[model samples]
Target: MSRAFNFCAGPAALPEAVLRQAQAELLEWGAERASVMEVSHRGAAFEALVAQAEADLRSLMGIPDDYAVLFLQGGATQQFALLPMNLAAPGQGADYVVSGHWSQRAVAEGEPHVRTRVLVDAADAAGLYLRAPEVDAAAVDPDAAYLHYCHNETIHGVEFPAVPDSGAVPLVGDFSSTILSRPLDVARFGVIYAGAQKNIGPSGLALVIVRRDLLERAGQPRARVLTWAAHARAGSLLHTPPTFSIYLAALVFAWLREMGGLEVMAAINQRKAQRLYHAIDDSEGFYRNPVDPASRSWMNVPFWLHDEGLNAAFLEESREAGLLALKGHREIGGLRASLYNAMPEAGVAALTDFMGDFARRKG
Candidate 1:
């Protein structure tokens, strides 16, 4: 049987070639004839793998020498708390621009650890997260430990039009959904972090890119394991790392490089997004995407049916047609399609074709 087109938000789709490579090597990885998971991270072969992975990532993203990249366990949610603990003093000010569910959750998680302040709340008059909020550079506190924002909200299908200006204050971004989708200006921000599941490879691993100088700050004391500086110094092998996830992410990095890196990816991703959004818009009363056009997420596109009663029929038929995981998040129920890098353009074409057919019969 053929593989189904998956549109899951996190633990999203991965490139078919990467999966084939992993399968080919799953039985025997190195000299010991052991899987990567069975091998010792301290071993030379696995250490080399880690080194190459970091080098590939650095090359793909054009990370500067002044920054350190750490691959650690726990998803981006853990970073919500760790960000404050590692970047700020006890209850020192940290400015957050709440754009959607994830950023709001970041504020909730960081409040206990740092002096959290809301710079811009994107909620509409009806308290709906249907639009992306803009952050003003002047409103940012210069003395604040860091300015925090979510570059893309996976749940709400909203994205920042561009990186918000932070001036002298260090800007920290949760780029979990849109990290490798396009080229980035790494030097513009103090730190950027993402969970591996969405665009990289899988869950159980998270990536952090931070400036070396920020690591020198006397942050709120915590376990060395939870400290970013310790992980950076130890080269992200503070303890038993998620070797399998790292291995998978490394393969993804190689795939991205072979495919011409972020420049190629950005064009492909933009085309994919435009095709899907156009389907939604052209559907007239048959479908609707509530997000503002300027703030629409290129990664996750959430939409609704004119007649909500037909939701189950649409999902069932789409599944039968090999389109899987089209259901929206439970928080805001409707339909969502997450177009991660690993998701082929053909998948989006398949989805739009299915959508048009469904709307015609069920409209």
Candidate 2:
């Protein structure tokens, strides 16, 4: 049986090649007659797997030797609190660029733990999130612990086309929805984190890349599990880690490396997004993407049908046509097509073709 093209925001699509490989090794991962999940994380087999994973990820991202990559549990949402807890000193504030729902949540989570300063809130007068606001470098507080921003706003379909200028402040990014979809300058940020469910692998794992120097700045966290230093000290094996998720993520990293890493992936992703956006743009007022063109997200594209009454029918037909998870979030009812790395060009082509056909019939 063939697989359907999945457009889920998370726990999303993974490379079919990786899935097949995992299926082949489900019972025995190597010479050891046990699956990767069954093996002790402390064992040599798992250790080697993790090391290779880190190496491949580093190579793929061009991560520096001065940075430490930690494969952690809990999703990116957990980091909302942990980041401020670990990075900020008593009474010290962190600056945030509130572009959409996730960034707003990060600020709310950090407020009780530390002083949270809003640098730029991108919402319009109606509180609608539609663009990435421009940052004034002069307004950023130099004494702030770090300047935090979401690399991509998954829900709002907004993305920072380039890294924001932080001036003297160290940049921190929540890259959950955008990581590995393109090349990133790891050296520009104090920390970068992503949940492994989207482009990486499955849920239950978050990958954090932190600059070595900044690790010492981590204060006593509210909990031991929340400390970046502790996780770094134990090599992300502080406790029983998410073994299966990490193993799957390792497979993804290897798969990414084989596909010529992020540089190649970026080009493919760009083309996929372009084709879909063209379909929407050429729909002759039948569909609309509200996001600012400059801040449009390459990974997630959300568009609305002019006739809202047609949404259910559109989604039903899309699902029947082997395009799954095309329904947008309930908060913002429309349609969203998440074009993660694993979503092939063929999927985008099929979706665009369907959209064109549907528009011609219904318009």
Candidate 3:
């Protein structure tokens, strides 16, 4: 059977070429006798793998040398708790801008560790959840440890065109859903983290690129294991790293480079999003996207059917038509098409064709 276009928000699609290469090299990576998963991470080959991956990432994002890149475990969800644990001193608070479900979850998780001040909530805009809120940087507490936000709210289908300008305060961002989709000025952010599943590679590995100064600030009462300084100093070789996932991500980075890097990827991503959003807009009320047009996400596009009853049928038909994972997130009972870096333009065209037929028949 042929592969279907997978639209899952995370654990999403990976490049076909990368997968094929992995299959070819699974038994022996170059001259090594073992698979990357079977090899010791401390070995020279794996060490080179780690260094190259970091170098590629640094080049792609133009990350400064002063920042340390740590690939840790526990996913982005873990970082929600770890961020506050590391950044927020006991009584010192931090600002959380709730733009959607993920950011709200981050606030909820961080609240126990620190006094969470919700700086902005954009839930009511266009009936969507997290979005780029109308926030005034001056409103945030000057003494707050840092400002945290989710750059792209996956479920709510909202994102910021650029990082929010929060003055002197360090900006921490959850870039899980949208990382590597486009170019970014890494220096603009104090800390940026993302789960590898979305645009990177697979689950189990989470990448955190943090400023060296922030690591010094994570002086928690807990053991050093939770601190970024510990991990960075140890070179992210802590506790048997996710060797396979990291290797896969490295392959993905190489694939991106072969395909002309993030600049070209960004252009393709923007075009793919524009095609689908245009389809939604041209449908004449048959389909609607709830996000504010200006703040809509290029990575994930969530649209609703005019008739609620057709939801199940739409998903079923889409599946039968070889489109996989068209179902929306449970929190939002509508279809969401996540056009991540791995999803091809052909898939978007196929989906638009399906939407056109479904709308003509149902409308």
TM-scores of all candidate predictions against the true structure: 0.98, 0.98, 0.97
What residue runs in model 1 are displaced by over 4 Å at the alpha carbon? none
Residue-wise lDDT of candidate 2 within 1-363, one digit each (tens)?
A: 468999999889999999999999999989889888899999998889889999999999999999999999889988888887888898899999999999999999888888999999999999889999898888999999999999899999999989988998889999999999999999999999998899899999999999998888856446777888888898888899999999999999999988988999999999999998899998888999988899999999999999999999999999899999998988787999999999999999999999998999999
User: Per-residue lDDT of 221-319 in model 3, one digit per residue for the tens?
Assistant: 777778888899988886688999999999999899888989999999999999999999999999999677889999999999999899998999999
User: Of 1 and 3, which scores higher on TM-score?
Assistant: 1
lDDT of 2: 0.92
Question: What C-alpha RMSD separates each model from the true structure?
Answer: 0.9, 1.0, 1.3
Q: Sort by TM-score, best first: what order?
A: 1, 2, 3
Q: Of the candidates shown, which would achieve the greatest lDDT relative to the real structure?
A: 1
Q: Itemize residue pairs with steric clashes in candidate 1.
A: none
Please report how far candidate 3 places residue 10 from its true position, in Å: 1.2
Count the clashes in each prediction: 0, 0, 3
- What's the CA error at residue 197 for candidate 3, in Å? 0.9
lDDT of each: 0.93, 0.92, 0.90
